[model samples]
Target chain A: MKVNELVQKLELEVLCEGESFFSDIDGCFAGDLLSLAMSNVRAGNVWITVQTNMNILGIASLTEASCTIVANGMNIPDAVIEKAKDENICLLRSEKGMYELCLSVGELI
Target chain B: MNSFKVQYTIDGEDFSVAGEASRKLKKVLQSLGVDPQIIRKATVAMYEGEINMVIHADGGVIDAEITPEKIHLFLRDKGPGIPDIALAMTEGFSTASDNVRELGFGAGMGLPNMEKYTDYMNIITEIGVGTTIEMIVNTSLS
Candidate 1:
């Protein structure tokens, strides 16, 4: 699923679009723990987390994650949004909490 | 097959800039046309080490050497060393503060993840002195 689709499906706001569009996601891992997420998530997984920080972009880069969904309507810091754009990592914002967002996205995937 | 080297200083006192070195290394490897799997391994291993540096030590230095044969990484920190390497290697054990946990790391899997992805890992530390970790990821065969 492309990030645009996710944005539309979940009614998420586009905080920033990194590198245009990524068409498909292989899996989904919803976690904030960097170590566990890196070890368990695959290259194309859509990372769903509430943490809106630059390190999230770093983790996305390491894991080659397709997109990052910041859950619970959290405000993303400007520096982080810029970094995500620079690194071509898509960033999305969801008003829903972590659990519900994961469940809905999981159903889509 | 030529060798490339880059060095980065990690400030352990600041958690915000933890993975800068790993992020740069990943980009360099990608540009070098390294296999995705090998690049992923190197990046993840180095990232774990990078996070450990910030969380445990005040910070440290990460030296990355990339060549056709392998990727060599060194993370050296001047912080309280790990007293029990065996226990620290466990999956769920973590000495990270609650504040660090809230930032989405310090789950106690740093060393284990680094070890899992690299072909060789060496950790040397003295309780009061510091800790140094050296990891090698073979790229030629993989």
Candidate 2:
């Protein structure tokens, strides 16, 4: 499924617009640990985490993940949002917890 | 074949900027048309090294050499050296502080992951002096 479709289906907020919202989602990875996430998350997967720091963008780009969904309605910093735009990484915000987000993503993809 | 080299200095004081070097390297590799799989391996290995440098070492320097056949990375730090390389190599071993863990790292998988992704890895360290790690990912690998 494309990211925009998933965003609309889940009612996710676009924290920052990336290069494209039409990127394909291959899978979902839920974690807060950056190192573990980088080591384990598959490319083209939707990364689900509460990490709102700028480093997440680096991890997302490095892993080639489709997009990152910040769970539980956390506030992502403006600098991070700017970096996301610069890196062309789609950043999404979701009010659902990580578990619910994963379940919904699983159903969609 | 021609080669390209880049060097970066990691700041230990800031946890926010830990993976910058690896991210830059990934972009360079992508622009150079390196295989995606190979780029992933190199980026993961080097990013782990960068994290270790920030969490363990006060900071460090990374020197990367990219060539047609392989990507070589050298990570050096002047932090308290690893007292036991073997134990440190263990998957669950970590000396990072609680604060570091709060930042979403220090699971003790950094070195192992680096070794796992790279075709070759070497570590050189001294008790109170520093540590230097060299890792190579062969682009020829399929």
Candidate 3:
């Protein structure tokens, strides 16, 4: 499914809609460990993590993930949000936990 | 053949800028027409090393030498060196504090991930003195 369609279907809160929001999403990979996620997540995968730090943005951009869903309603610092905008990374947030979001994203993509 | 070089001194106290060097290196590799997968492997490796510098070493200097055949990363730090390289190399081993964990790092995956993503990696460290790491990623110029 497309990034926008998946976001709509899952009812994700759009913290920032980057250019990739209009791109296609192929799979879902959920992990909070930056290094592992960096290694495992592929291009166009929607990464599910509770990490709201700046490194997540770097990982998201490096891996070129479709979008990163910060689950569990984690509070993302403004600095991180600004970094996301500057990098043009598609970052989303969800009230739901990682497991639930993964299921939803898995089904859609 | 002449190689492209990029260097950055990571601010050990700053979390936001830890991976800046890797990001720049990735862009340089991209502009030079490096392979996508090669770029991914090189950047990931470089980023992990860069973060490691900021976290464990209190910041360090990272130099990237980019050539058609490969990319070499040399990281140097004056932070307390590793006492047990073997234990540190094991997965799920980290000396980082609880604060670092909340940021989604310090899972003990950085070093292993560096080795995993690089073609060659070497470390020279002395406790209370400093540590230096060298990693290389082979690329396809053709």
Candidate 4:
């Protein structure tokens, strides 16, 4: 599934678009532990997490996760959003919790 | 590939700039057209190491030695040297403050993750002095 379709279907809030509009979503991974997530999230996975720090962008870019969906509507810092833009990693936000977000992603991708 | 060393001075304990070292190195590798998987491995190792520097050592220096065959990374920190290297290597063990955990790291996976991603790894430290980690990722390995 492409990211734009999922964004519309899931009603996600796009905090930063980067260049991930049509990027393919290969799978879905949900984790908050940065190291664990680093070791686990595969390339092109739509990673869902509650981590909104700038470091999350690092993890996302390192793992090549297609997009990061910050769950529970967390307030991502401006630095993070700006870094995401600079690095071209898509950052999205959702009002749902991690579990619910995973459920929604499961249905689509 | 020409052999060269790229060094970055990690600044302060600021979480805001935690991963710049690794990120910049990743870009350099990309510019060199390094393999994507190799780049990911190198970046992950250095990113975790960079975060450790900020969280525990109050920042440090990361040097990437790029060559025809591999990339050698040197991470040096002058913080409280690790008391027990074995314990620090164990997964899920951490000495980071609560605030560090709140930033979404500090699950004690830093050193282990570095080992997992690189082809060769070594550590040198003195309790009153500092800690230095050397990791190698060979481009020809995979």
Measured by DockQ, the strongest candidate is 3
- Candidates ranked, most accurate by DockQ first: 3, 1, 2, 4
DockQ of each: 0.79, 0.79, 0.81, 0.76
Where does candidate 4 clash, by residue pair? none
Reference-based lDDT, residue B81, model 4: 94
Candidate 4, residue B1: the lDDT equals: 74
Is candidate 3 or 4 superior in TM-score? Answer: 3
Error of 3 at A72 (Å): 2.0
- Candidate 3 residue-wise lDDT, A1-109, digit = tens: 8988987898989988998999999787899888889898999999999988888988898898999999999999998888788889999999999889877777666
List the global CA lDDT of all models: 0.85, 0.90, 0.88, 0.89
| lDDT-superior candidate, 2 or 4 | 2
* Residue-level error in angstroms, candidate 2, position A19: 1.4
Residue-by-residue lDDT tens digits, candidate 2, B66-95: 999999999999999999999999998999
**Residue-level lDDT tens digits of model 1 in A1-109:** 7767877888988777776355677788998887888777788788888888678887876787778888888888899988777777878888899899888988897
Spell out the clash pairs found in candidate 1.
Answer: B12-B58, B12-B59
Q: Which stretches of candidate 4 lie over 4 Å from their true place?
A: none
Which docking category, incorrect, acceptable, medium or high, applies to candidate 3? high
lDDT of 2 by residue, A9-75 (tens): 9999997758658888898899998888998788889999998877898888888888899999998
Regions more than 4 Å wrong, model 2: none
* Pairs of colliding residues, candidate 3: none
Per-residue lDDT tens digits for candidate 4, residues B25-127, read 9899999989888988999899889989988888988889999899999999998898899999999999989998987789999999999999999999999
- For all predicted structures, in order, the TM-scores are 0.92, 0.95, 0.95, 0.95
